[model samples]
Target: MTNRSEAGWNFDNSYAWLPKTFYSSLNPTPVSKPKLIIFNEKLAESLGLNGRNLQSEEGTEIFAGNRLPDGAVPLAQAYAGHQFGHFAMLGDGRAILLGEQITPDGKRVDIQLKGSGRTPYSRGGDGRAALGPMLREYIISESMQALGIPTTRSLAVVTTGEDIIRETLLPGAVLTRTASSHLRVATFQYAANWGTDEDVRTLADYTINRHYPDIEENENRYLSLLEEVIKRQASLIAKWQLVGFIHGVMNTDNMAISGETIDYGPCAFMDTYDPATVFSSIDRQGRYAYGNQPYIGGWNLARFAETLLPLLHEDEKKAIGIAEDALAGYNEQFQSYWLAGMRAKLGLLNEEKEDETLIADLFKMMHAYQADYTNTFRALTFEDYEDTALFGSKEFTQWHEQWQARRGKQEKSNELSHQVMQSSNPAVIPRNHRVEEALKAAVEEGDFSVMEKLLQVLAKPFAHTPDQEEYCELPEPSKTPYRTFCGT
Candidate 1:
């Protein structure tokens, strides 16, 4: 067995120093036959794990939770969340955060193991994961990062060589997930509900120091933290909308306080420009549809603010007023950010008063004609309308003329506007059908070339390439709509 020193794991876990009630220290349930499937060599190097020993059998054992590394402290964090609008206590069910890895850049990041094993928070369910969902997360999260979105990253996936029964028996796998921090809004909710005022205060200080350190010196650091969090979330959700990403589930627990995207379960991008689009098999009511994301962002922030009531003010009524007043700015902040992003996507360098109406009109036409969201923006970027059905409509023709006149008003030439649009809009997305195709090839046939191609293309989302053309094709129309499962 390879010793811990050779693996290059520079762990300095601060979360483990927290009160025992914050998390339960434990070891992963050992797997029988752990084997490496794929390891992220680039990410490993960034985390200072750039050693020759990582891709070997001993490294697979570390990722599979069959062996422990030096200074590794495994634990499952405790918290509560509102799932689908109902309050419930929850925690890490099938995941264990190994420790905080101090990277070469002097940054602390969580190195976690998903599908590690059962913890105290398992709640009657088997703590395991299927190979397909792990790969799906690996692909999608990396795609998000490439698109300049803040997100958790996947480091490796190792097969357990065991069965994980989800609707049926399937192969089990473990994913090594890295993130800035795993602290969620639900963590505050958990602290407020179960711990004392001192606990909430301590957590707030820790959060401010770790994430919003600029505000730590301010007298009203807690309120500043709230506002900063709201701002980051405003920008994050706008980016998601601009790209047509449907998070599918927006529970408070899934909302990362570090301003990075977490929990890629049941998430998918839009194939068609419909505000009512939902892809999660469990979302029967469409509570988390494409259009509802902005509102849900506000709702979740309000919940987070509520958790800060104890720290926001001494009196309850005063605290409620303060939270409401701060929340009042959320919609305006979101609108400003979204409108700015939309302007960039449309290649509008300078904002005009009519820009909002112009953008709305284009969306209306897109929805009316059922235009593909990503392709529509890409079409505008390249002025490519030969085979596009949206361009055939007279309404679109008039809108196109209006857009040209609007473009004519810009100070810069059309070349610069084209550049802006090209940079803002992606040439390819992880199309639903293509993702499924890759997943099936890897999981069922053990053919990884399909996924490799998809990952390579997704790693550079803006630049157009010949291989991107095949992935740009829409999914075949089917009687039943495409659906994604949590696969927990």
Candidate 2:
């Protein structure tokens, strides 16, 4: 009922000052009632919010978009996207950005209310979110941050006390999320295709100033901006590969300009080391499988580069050439990052000419043996991989000898190699079954303890503590391959 000035929300409302076409100003359609489900205390404090003040009904309502804090200006952004490879005009259908907050570190970050309500781009869909999906985002996103991956974060999830009709009457909820900025590849795409050339230049300049400030004075700032984004995305995808995280839906719009992992929709960490592993129910073609992530990352970035052609050079041909030259290096850049990362995982201190072959052969064997990805790496790091069943086979026995021989050539001692491996591999991930178990408990049984414990375990992914042992083990095999829905 009252503004949350006491909650320490210092809103700057800068994005709202953009041209009207960039967004549409609106208030969230009020929910019947809002009940707080979870609050991220550490993130709240980091953003300079008074955590105690945000734990009340008033706080819950603020996230639910039923209450406004001081300096708040809610709007749904306008953008176009390539969804499953088809271009479409789209915008924020169920999410509302409530101004950028100036954090204690003096960083400007977007605070968005997802599942807030419908806007101009609702497209006849109910702009409400279900409780299960909201909680799923909270668990996975927070886990990503803990694992040192750049990502948008979930601050709170609040129940709307109303049913969101999907296949069934599921309870509605709202997720208060935060990110460096919500600028996506689709944002640039929209400006390029629909808005004037001036619009594209304006957005490119704004993005450089905000995300790549050092590049602001570069001779070719726009081209330099593209190069920086390409580098960032290359490294980010490499990290995702090392950890076996699959972003099931990677529509260009889902690709954030800040290079953070955005949208947790239908995403999952792989249980086994199969490159073809996929969990998204909608991604039947496997275009975005675990193994194809790097290629898809390149594909999405190419789409982004197209949006910047006008800003890259004056002559259309020269622009194409500049973009082509820049885009051409994506594979090399991605390979450089991925190779370096894989080397760390295998505890290889010094690179060898056959390093790529060594890693490729390992993956081939893993695919053949169905070895658990995270567990195998963790066991190797801890020196217990020899006890695993995968090592019982003759093929694995020979491979182990080769790996041992490779390690013998390392400049550092075995202890240092193991240390590097420990940091490179995670002892735990948000297992799909465990995540479902927590969601089922919270949404069906009204229990939060399961999720809370899982979060605690995930917070220290490399800790290797006894509490993480259970999570380190994979869930019992199910006859059906796991399927995840967008749950929008």
> In model 1, which runs have C-alpha deviations exceeding 4 angstroms?
none
The lDDT for every candidate, in the order shown, is 0.91, 0.92
Backbone clashes in model 1, listed as residue pairs: none
Candidate 2 ranges with C-alpha deviation above 4 Å: 386-389
Worst 10 residues of 2 by lDDT: 383-392
User: Once model 2 is optimally superposed onto the true structure by TM-score, how far is the C-alpha of residue 362 displaced, in angstroms?
Assistant: 0.9
Give the C-alpha miss distance for residue 286 in model 1, angstroms: 0.6
Q: Write the per-residue lDDT of candidate 2 for residues 1-488, one digit (tens) a residue.
A: 55748999899988887788899999988899899999999999999999899998778889888888778898999999899999999999999999999998999999999999999999888999999999999999999999899999999999999998999999999999999999999999999888999998888988998899999989999999999999999999999999999999999999999999999989999988898999999999998999999999999999999999988888999999999999899999999999999999999998899888888888888888888898888878887876454878888778888999999987799999999999989999999999999999999999999999999999999898888888877788799999999987
lDDT of 2 at 14: 80
What TM-score does structure 1 among the candidates reach?
0.98
Worst 10 residues of 1 by lDDT: 1-10
